[model samples]
Target: MSDLAILKRRHALLGEKAPLFYEEPVHIVRGEGVWLYGPNDEKYLDGYNNVPTVGHCHPHVVDALAKQAGKLNVHTRYLNEEILNYGERLTATMDDSLSRAFFVCTGSEANELAIRIARCATGGMGIIGSDATYHGNTSTVMELATNRKMGGPKRKKSNVRSVPFPQMYRAPKGMSEGALAQAYAAEIQAAIDDFEKRGIKFAGMLVCPIFANEGLPDVPLGYFELMQQIVHGAGGVIIFDEVQSGFGRTGSMWGYENTGIVPDIVTMGKPMGNGHPLAGVVCRPELGDAFHAESTYFNTFGGNPVSCAVGNAVLDVLEQEQLVEQAAEVSAYLRSGLDLLKNDFDLIGDIRNNGMFFAVELVKNRKKKKASKKKPLRIVNMMKEKGVLISSIGADRNILKIRPPLPFTTDHADIVLEKLTECLIEVEG
Candidate 1:
């Protein structure tokens, strides 16, 4: 079908507001390692998808899925050795405290279950999230997505509160990094105090360790440490939403590994099953026990045999290929290339990256750092036309988000940098 025809049908069925990339959406028909193919077989370098963590249709992952499905695919209610094996292997990569696992089908479901566990274990109702971040789309989790900065109408939920995520690029003038960290951490304490004032017991603070959605900002030094002190002091747990930053995306097994503090719970998904619907929450044993004891929770297909097989295959690829180390090396090379671009392009304000994930903020004036909201979309569309796929993030929608599959190499980085430079020139003109 034609792009216009598909678009028309998409709008009719999925509603006009369903999101699509670029001004002219490409009709993708298939995918392979680090690339997507149009219906006509024109290939575009994939640089914005994290779901296919290992790579698109990796033979190993595909084989595992096929083999498992051919043998058996059933819900989690029955005895499933795949779940037990995968769970043991997965948690062994984390801090010893986070030893228990709860299976779920999506990042949203993982986060929802994490929150439920926090509330149950802590005996509190209040939840905290970043002012300009997203966790998921479920009703309760949607509360975290409703903060004013996201441009959505605020949901009036008394039990939820949001604090400014710390970022050095936009810190108040003349404030030291230490002060900035303190100021940001103070916001969490303020929220906790507010919950107490309003007679709401504090549950926990949940946020992305690297603040990926907040433009992948360079968090002020010592922020996580102060945040740990404040949250734990208030008798609240810490939940790190590693949905995007986990599975070696951060050059580490987990995003929290880069941070100084350890979280009480971690929710992960996206890349877990390498495009399969597998996601989960890992937490302290006490919290897991309390949650299960008080509230019954079971997802019918969360930890199915097929999903676990896919998850295992993804892990196998990560280990056998050493993609985590590659993410570090390639991302460093790519960031250096972007640094060179920043030196030439006055529109480039700041560039931040976490391993394979990158955010390049565009500005109308470098001195003022005024976000150039319109230019990013233009650049993204232009890059799309150039046979490269990229996207934008941040509250202003002015930061380019380039996160590709794990197999992306320096060659792929060169293509991204070359296309980006051309787009910047044309957009600047």
Candidate 2:
């Protein structure tokens, strides 16, 4: 079918608001390694998807998934050794305190479970999230979604509070990094205090440790440490939503490892099963026990045998191929290349990265640090025209988000860099 016909059918069946990439979306039919193929055999370098973290259609993950599906596929209630073994191996990568796991089919469900655990353990309804961030789509978790684009609650829920995410690029003039960290941490404390004043008990703060949705900002130093103390002192848990920053995307196994603070509960998604629907929450034993005691939680397809096999296989690929270390090395190379581009392009404002994930902020005026909202989307579409795929993020949607599969190498980075340089020149002209 033609693109227009497909689009018409999509709009009619799935509603007009369903999101698609670029002004003209690609009709991707096949994906392998770091590339996606269209119907005419035209291939585009995949540079924006973390869902296939180990690379799309990796033989290892696909084989494991197929083999397990052929043998058995059952929910968590069944006696399943695959689930137990996978769970044990997965949590072993985390801090000792985070030794328990709860499986779910999507990030939304994982985050919902994390919120439930926090509220159950702390006896509170108050939760804190970043002012420009998205956690999930579930009605309960959507209350924490303050991103206007996500269509969160029209009115701010009294139980939910948002704090300005810390970003060094836009720090108030003359404020030291140390002071900025304290000021950001104070925002959390203020939220907690307000919750108390409003007679709402404090539950916890949930955010991506790397602040991926907040333009991957260079966070202020000592911010999370102070936030940790403030939250714990207020008798609340710390929940790190690692849906975008987990499974070696951040060089470390978990996003929380990069931050000084150790989250009480960590939620992971997307990359866990390498395109399979697998996501879960890892928390302290006490929190898991408390949540389970209070409510019986069960998911039909979460941690099914096939999902566990795929999850285990993804870990196998990560370890055998050493993708985590490769991410660190390739990201360093990409960072240096991006620095060279920054010198050549006046549109470049700030570049921030965590391992393989990168965000390049565009600016109309570097001196004033004005966000170039239109240029980012235009550049993204232009890069798509050049056989490369990327996207835009941030509250103003002026930050280029370049996050590809784990198999993406220095060579792939070079292609992205080359295409990006050309696009910037055209956009500037």
Query: What does the lDDT read for residue 34 in candidate 1?
Result: 94
Model 1 ranges off by over 4 Å? 147-157
**lDDT tens digits by residue: candidate 2, 1-429:** 999999999999999889988999889999999999999999999999999999999999999998999999988886869988999999999999999999999999999999999999999999999988888899888987776667666534468899999989999999999999999999999999898988899999999999998889999999999989999999999999999999999998888888987899999999998889999999999999999889999999999999999999999999999999999999999999999999999999999899999999999999999999799999999999999999999989999999999898999999999999999999888
Question: Model 2 — which ten-residue stretch has the worst lDDT?
Answer: 148-157
**Top TM-score model:** 2
Q: Assess candidate 2 and give its TM-score to the true structure.
A: 0.99
lDDT (Cα, tens digit) per residue for candidate 1, span 362-401: 9999999999979999998989999999999998899999
Instruction: Give the RMSD in angstroms, all C-alphas superposed, for model 1.
Output: 1.3
Candidate 1 achieves a global lDDT of 0.92
Per-prediction TM-score to the true structure, in the order listed: 0.98, 0.99
